[model samples]
Target: MDKYDVVVIGGGPGGYVAAIRAAQLGGKVCVIEKGHLGGTCLNRGCIPSKAIITSMKLLSLIKSSSSFGIDVQGYQINFPKVISRKDEVVLKLRQGIGGLFKAKKIDLKNGDYSNRFRAA
Candidate 1:
């Protein structure tokens, strides 16, 4: 019953950005996202995992740095710190997307956009 120039589903990196860009281009846009903004990449899959992996890599490099004449000892993985940093990163990005949506004056619909979306 309602009209929109563009409807974006998923609200992940691709969907959100597309919605914002469409609005910037002078289209009436609405985003339907099942969960939080930034989607799987920002929430669970890539971004968080990569943050942990990078921390792991740092630990690895530090452990094996003796070959380069760098001596280190008593180093361990601080799981809480890693988790905290990852959460921090995700939070910032999520807030950023929210800010973008607000600035662009796009309508945000919190729902599952996998196979269905309706505007009214």
Candidate 2:
């Protein structure tokens, strides 16, 4: 059986940050994520939402650029491309977090360990 000084149940920002801090303090940490790392923030809510917001902000700025002496031509939003970009952003951030876990030597498990979990 694997042993861990700190076992984080969720992979959300709080949980992952806690695990990393514990590891930095010289503890063996494990993160059990039933879903993707970063939970709703990185997957659905925060990061992905922010990604779309950024795109929208850029579009808004471009639309208002004519008032700032910047001429704009026929431009439209490629929604499919926008969605693709958001997906790419989310994927990159998730991979980056996974990389950090590996670098810190933290064990990341992708399953529900609710009943099987025990602090060791």
Candidate 3:
């Protein structure tokens, strides 16, 4: 079994950032992420919310375009399209962060674990 200098339990912003810093300092690091890379921030929480907010802002701008003296009408917000775009943005950012982790040579493990230590 290979022992790492550091083992991080989460892949959230804090954990992943710590792992990267440790690796930069020449320490062998491994990150255990039961969920997707970038953790909640980049996976299901912050990034998703930000993307949705972006869509909302865009929709608002379109709806209020006439206020800016731009002649526009029949503007509609496609909820499904907005959601799809948000998912794409989140996925792209997640993959980019994952690539960064890989470039830093941080071992990323994805799976659920319990309190079980088997004897070899």
Best by TM-score: 2
lDDT tens digits, residue span 1-120, model 1: 557899887789899989999999999999988799998889999999999999999999998999999999889888999999999999999999999999998888897656654434
Candidate 3 lDDT over 20-77, as tens digits, reads: 9999999999888888878777878888999999889887888888889986778777
lDDT of 2 by residue, 56-75 (tens): 99999999999999988998
lDDT to native, each model: 0.90, 0.91, 0.83
Off by over 4 Å in 1: 1-3, 112-120
Question: How does candidate 1 score on lDDT?
Answer: 0.90
Best by lDDT: 2
TM for every model, in the order presented, reads 0.84, 0.91, 0.88
Angstrom error of the Cα, residue 113, model 2: value is 1.5
Alpha-carbon RMSD, each predicted model: 2.7, 1.5, 2.4
Per-residue lDDT for 89 in model 3?
A: 91
What TM value does model 1 have? 0.84
Error of 3 at 95 (Å): 1.0
Clashes of each: 0, 0, 0
Candidate 3 has which clashing residue pairs, if any? none
